[model samples]
Target chain A: MTTPPPHRPVPQPTQRVVVTSPRTRAPRARRPYSGTREINEQSELGAVYMRTLIRAQRRLGLSVCLVTTGVLALLPLLFSLEPALGRFRVFGLGLPWFLLCVATFPMLLLAGWFYVRQAERSEREFAELVERP
Target chain B: MTSGYAVVAVLVVVLGTILVGAYGLRVSRTTSDFYVASRTVSPWWNASAIGGEYLSAASFVGIAGLIFAYGPDMLWFPVGYTAGYLVLLTMVAAPLRRSGAYTLPDFAEARFRSRAVRGVASVLALAIGWLYLLPQLEGAGLTLNTVTGAPDWVGALIVMVVVTVNVMSGGMRSITFVQAFQYWLKLTAITVPIVFLVVVWQVHGAESLTAPEYPAFRQDTEVTFNNDTMIHAERSLAIRGTGEVDGVRVDGGFVLTDGYHRIGQGSEFTFPKDATVPHLSTMAHNTNESWALPESSGADFPLYGAYSLIIATFLGTMGLPHVIVRFYTNPNGTAARRTTLILLGLLSVFYLMPPVYGALGRLYTPELLMTGQTDAVVLVLPARVVDGIGGELLGALVAGGAFAAFLSTSSGLVVSLAGVLSQDVLRLGGVRGFRISAVLAGVVPLAMTFVSTGMPVADMVGLAFAVAASSLCPLLMLGIWSSRTTTVGAIAGMLAGGVPALTAGLVTMFTDTGDAWYEVLLSRPAAWTVPLGFTVMYVVSLLTQRHVPPGVQRTMVKLHAPENLGLDGSGPGSGDERS
Candidate 1:
């Protein structure tokens, strides 16, 4: 995010007074011992490193959530449009029953397993990048 | 079923929960803290604890009841409930724990740095917890009413007193192991009976569930209608009864016509073996063929109903007050994530048992449809299908398990709600604050059950999820992922989404406007309200961009970064290089 130059505070006549400038801009990127020091003190460079980690993790979470929920959401419409599909037997049980009751659990577990693996991997990669000598 | 065994079972479950809470209370945190937040209990044990706390009255009895009354379409309930944890695992599990706030309100205040947002979050937390607790109390009443032929309020009072005493006494101090013990107790109570019941079903020739014939009583049966009920008979039938039908007293034989008939309160009917059963008017009159198939939920918009239920449940689990507290038992972010995944497996195995009871209830307990006590299917089915003393023992086992579900879930809800209530509302700090809040929490919902119209227990639980999905879900999702959310936007988004959903849920519960076109919309508002909350929060935050929290960067670091990194905006940086 681009930090704005400081501005004078002005009280609004209609509402409560609001601050014009951010007090949270990490005291101008002080020179520090390491990246850890930079982050601990909240420098611009430290914000960059933190943003990278957040972006990677968010993308992983969004993709997994969307794909799994998106695919499952189509089941009700499928059963409605093609009535015969719901009736088709799978292993001697109705397909809708088989899919919704039996098959969905393992699929959810598999998706969760995939998410954990990827999330930890990215966290590891970020640590290695930050902790370099 | 004999009342003796069932009565004994209920007493044992009550005593068992009390004993377990007392046992947990006696052990101080240092020794018992092994499995609590201090890295003593491993992730799997924590998962079981969550499972214990979560496999509430809804999963145990309500799912099976709804499925029995409707059809296979109700399978979505179990599916959605499990998938909620999956969503929690993928999205909120790690980051939430890393945020270092034990409750949802804490997350709001920490993120927004505004008391206004925290106040709004606290209100919603209390509202959602109370709404969720309402059904657990109702389910307890229903179970007791069925088992001992006691009044509906007696069982509810027992649960309220027992749980209130437990929490007030601080017996749930080390709740992790106690909750885990509850999970195993509920699992066994539900599982062992299924094996025996299924074996009995197979021995009875595994009769086809999808057969075209209407369900017929296997032997001569006598039915008593304790409350006034309108029933629908598919064909003309002769019935023997003593009570009012069509406002005419028939002390002897009467012919039930091919259409609707009102069986007056306290009426008893005796039917010959192989007589066709007439189901209650509230039920969708379905033959075996239609009921076993999907999309036969008998509602006008079955598709919309299913989708709404899915949306509410899949996103709502993270917003629950009690569920959020369990995350703290884990030592760090990764442990929390692992705990959630193990919970998914635990929940999946428990969920599988409910639908089994539902399917079998359609066969052995078709009379439940006639009596409009379909929610009792789980408790009554064991005795109906299996014969002799074995059935009595198994029925007693199911009764005890149902009590376990009610006690575990409601107590968890009360304790967490009391936590929020004391800190936010009562402003009390010590044990005395918690005690007052706990009593108030139990008292408000128990009073509610006395006046409630008593809808099916599962559907009541779903409305609680709807409220969470509409209000708190947005706050958690937006507050975590988007740093630009401002104080004004947080308040506006919660009210905009929460009011409409909460109002709709309340409207559905207290009043019934028969077959209104908007009935589905009113009953299941999550399909629209969830997106409404998310959009309002995002758009408002964008408009009020200048009002973003000052310390958002530090807050983000605290939430998203691993704890071991020491980037928590504290003084770890100064000593880090030397160490």
Candidate 2:
């Protein structure tokens, strides 16, 4: 036994039908660019993305190599030009011994660390650019 | 020294390697597993393996001996070796890893799409690998002979057997674990002995290593010339010994002249305390002050030689087939860079110990300078500095470590060389083929050691580096970084740089070229060869610009892109096939 619903007056709603076609731009979904596909297909657009990444990495690598190894390559000339540097005491050891044996290791590690960080960052940026919506 | 303890130590290293490798064998069932552990290695694991393999006999024994004989200038060897990883990290490590290469030749083919380029790379890789192996074999013989009085061939034989047994049982997957374990063993073997030696040094009244006076016999010393030695004694001295000098036996007191005297094999000489030490004729820095200085030792064109050594080691590291193959074992490009960075740290720590041993040897083991067996300075220093049982125990630890170095390096080279031989040469693609190739790889180098004239271990290694830097370094540098490289340029560059450098290195190693003005140029060829390789590659590629591979755009993208960017494996731009 259900009770009868309360009676209420209802007003008619205003409505209009607008004509539209399937070819309307508003109905079509925009597709995100897949740089990955272009690169895979070896398209011109894909080549641009690849070039950007390769260029950035090559520049970082070249500069780092120059800064670290380029300077080191000059050391033999320095030692030759200033013979006294071979015997000058540093930390109770000859300068050459201290520099080559003790100092050079840490310096190499630091340079490597810097290069790795830069390379990772560049690769990350590349991934982001290619994958971005 | 103490052959009993040393023998025990050597046995432990050998047996331990075999057991560990057996464990690796269980996981290795496929061809990929045999070649590169299926590329699943983490940074820390691969880093340790790289360190174990990279610090060959050159770093373990050769660098210390060179430092002892040639003085501080020789410290450049350790420095250049460590710096090489830095060069690798900045330039080649990640790109090479992302290229999906199994070996250096695989990389060449992928880049150039030409069989001819791969052929040249494989040949150069084999040449460099064999050249590098010669020193390790030589050093093994030297170490065994120094500690155990074993025939020189005995140690090389032992190393070959142990490594082959291990590889036969497991392949690279087992070798990786064996090598990683060896790195720590080696570090401890060198480090622990040095700590006690330093304490002993301080307790013995802390003699100055850089003193102005020449090294003298601190106590009455009995010196044995294991190899034929030429020595320079500055003053007449009384000596009592049983041995041959100038091929004639002398068993009693004799007045040694002020000039050079040649001592034959099995010769023994006992020099009194405070007697001026007869110096090795080839190495002439007798005064501690001079020995402590750089560029004072008698290598001709010292500046050019040092610079050439620098170029060869720093650039050559990436091109080493064994070292290159190890990078391919990294799971991806990111891990490859991470591995190299960690490797730099591991190598730096180990390198510090060898130089310390060298410096201490100057004060304690000057007799090594008299005998040309300075390569054994690291093995001898621990026992000489510490006394009694403790010294003997330390000596054993070092001996064990030395064997570990030879085994790890040999295994790495054998794995890579076998990979090339079985896959490229024999066209055999299975675990059985790789196993057969492994044995073949070891035999060639072992046989070559019999014929090649032996140089000091570090010097031979330097020649290998020069060859590698001249040839493969150019190909990797150009191919990975530039898409313009053509097949003709690649082949041309490898031969131009490699052939002349190889000829020079062979000439230096096999033929005697004494005191000629041009001898230094031939002996230390990297100063010329590296530039030639890079220049020829660049210029020829530019000239043959239209001959570049049509698929190069895809290859370049594949090489330079991050793995997760979906550029992994054969096809790029495919839906995520991350497996």
Candidate 3:
């Protein structure tokens, strides 16, 4: 058998070290993020930059998710405040009610939809970048 | 209900899961493979595994029982459970996958760079995992006892033995296979019996018997909680079967009656019109009124506490140790994200079936709730709806699924606990330590099942959510994305959040005093404890932000950056961007 593509000197076998080096190169990635201009460059390096941009955009989506969920979680704290809107009065059970009926679930559903959209958008861009090669 | 075939079917399912795991032993050569399946599991497989682990015995039996006992209100459990994934998808799915950590504790150590925080997290993880496992073991014991008339311990022991072997032999790889298989088992178990039962009900021309036809069917039941206190339960309860009321022959006829009991402030009970039943004693709270469902039944409280619990489950999905660890088996974050979406669909399909059981429980067995047989509503459902061999077969199928649910969830929890215990608690640094920790993790809960027997399964699960939400949730949320996280803050927050929950949970669990403080602490602790934990972490983190280590920037980059950016120095630029 031909010498199996001379095992690229894998400097260290420790999982942590292997994962860290590429992490340091992350900042260099920001250099080519001039929106569509970077995409048009069509160079391999340009593809890499676009990939990085797609990733940053995805990270942006994640941040939005955090903010939304953070706010949503805090929704209950708002209701605990006295004199909210609406009440839960089914079968003579007079309970003070608010957004949970019309708002909480619907808001959650909306948030989920927005998140799926962002994730899908990022996935499509990444796929385009991958196809460039 | 006894069938040799039923016993064989259960054996086949259990043996099958263990055998699958045993078969995976060869692939688990490395420590990484043992813990996370070497980061190569596909989205479908991972989702299946998640679904398998997710459909626990509680979902199988307890929820239907809860619905049977509590009317339509119990439907919230399945809804909340399925919805929790949406929260996870938006907030945590990809970031957690990219964290490149093995367990939740690993995420804390990486994020806060604190061995102390890691230590505390490990302790909390172990505690929660152990706490969660006790119910699973108890459920197993209850299940086997119900199915075969076997001793309760035998069920716990059988599951314990199979799970230990499965976990030790293959780690996540074997578990992935076993769990996926279990999802189908759980689904089939739930669906087949339901369909068969519906067919049987149809044959009996159940349509002739409307809600108005039952003898004790009342237009309204005025539930007066005290000698003078009164609340009207406006909805009618259709009492099934034939009975003589006021010495009159009545087979499927109607009436309205008053059933009530006095309960102190912040107290909850189930009052029975007929005495000797448990849940009929309505849990009366002397009126902050928030403690009891508002005069609106459950229409109060924005979303019901049941829904709040669901929201926590959905958003809290990412915080779960067992659920998150499954993502590590994927090759990258994209796969992990996709796996989460698939999990949503799987969870949705599976959830559709619980309500049917719950609805049927309402029609066939109304007394289950009153007698604490609410837990058995799903278990005995087949016999109630259908007769003979078909019922026995369906029961066997459900038994197998319930067992599968127990094994998958228990093993996943055990694995997560084992990882944390070895890495942080015992500080057992290698592969050998992991295996030992795995076995030790399961043993504690197995032991606990023998000591504790009366705790309600649903309530115990709620306590687990509260503990997890209070402790790990705040820590995980702040640790990632927040540049201000510090070791001292994480440690302090965990203690503040975790200790009160642990104490309240223990008090609520071990004793039946039904004290007001217990209700405040156990039922609504999240409102106070969660804020306390966050406040401590936030304040401490802000104070310590100035002293952040030079490596903090680098770690953040690793966390936030893309996958393919080779960490090599080949990128045509500069220096190590150190502080």
Predicted model with the maximum lDDT: 2
Error of 2 at B220 (Å): 1.2
| TM-score of structure candidate 2 | 0.94
Q: What residue runs in model 2 are displaced by over 4 Å at the alpha carbon? A: A1-32, B568-579
lDDT over C-alpha atoms for residue B9 of model 1: 94
| Predicted candidate 1 versus true structure: per-residue lDDT over B302-397, tens digit per residue | 999999999999998888999987886676788888899899889888888888898888778878888898899999988888888899898899
Cα lDDT listed for each candidate: 0.82, 0.84, 0.62
lDDT of 3 by residue, B1-579 (tens): 355655776798888887788789976765656766756667898889889987787777777665454433445566567666775675566667677776888787767676777778878877778777877887887777667757678988988888877787788778888888888888888888888877877887753221322212112222211112222223333333343333444444344243442222222232334222213344322112232222212323433454346444544456667876776676666666677778877776777677567556655554443334457667767865777777777777787788888888898888888877776767675567777888898888888876663665765776676677778887877766565677777788889987887777776777664545336446535556777888898898788777454455445544544444322122233212210
Docking model 1 quality class: incorrect
**Model 3: residue B172 alpha-carbon error in angstroms:** 2.0
lDDT of candidate 2 over B247-346, digit per residue (tens): 7789887778778899888888898888878898888756888888888778888998998899999999988999998887786788899999999999
List, residue by residue over A14-113, the lDDT tens digit for candidate 2: 4352533111111221232476666666668777988998999999998988888887777778889999878689889888888888988888898889
Candidate 3 local distance difference test against the native: 0.62
Instruction: Give the TM-score of each candidate.
Output: 0.93, 0.94, 0.75
Q: What tier of docking accuracy does candidate 3 attain? A: incorrect
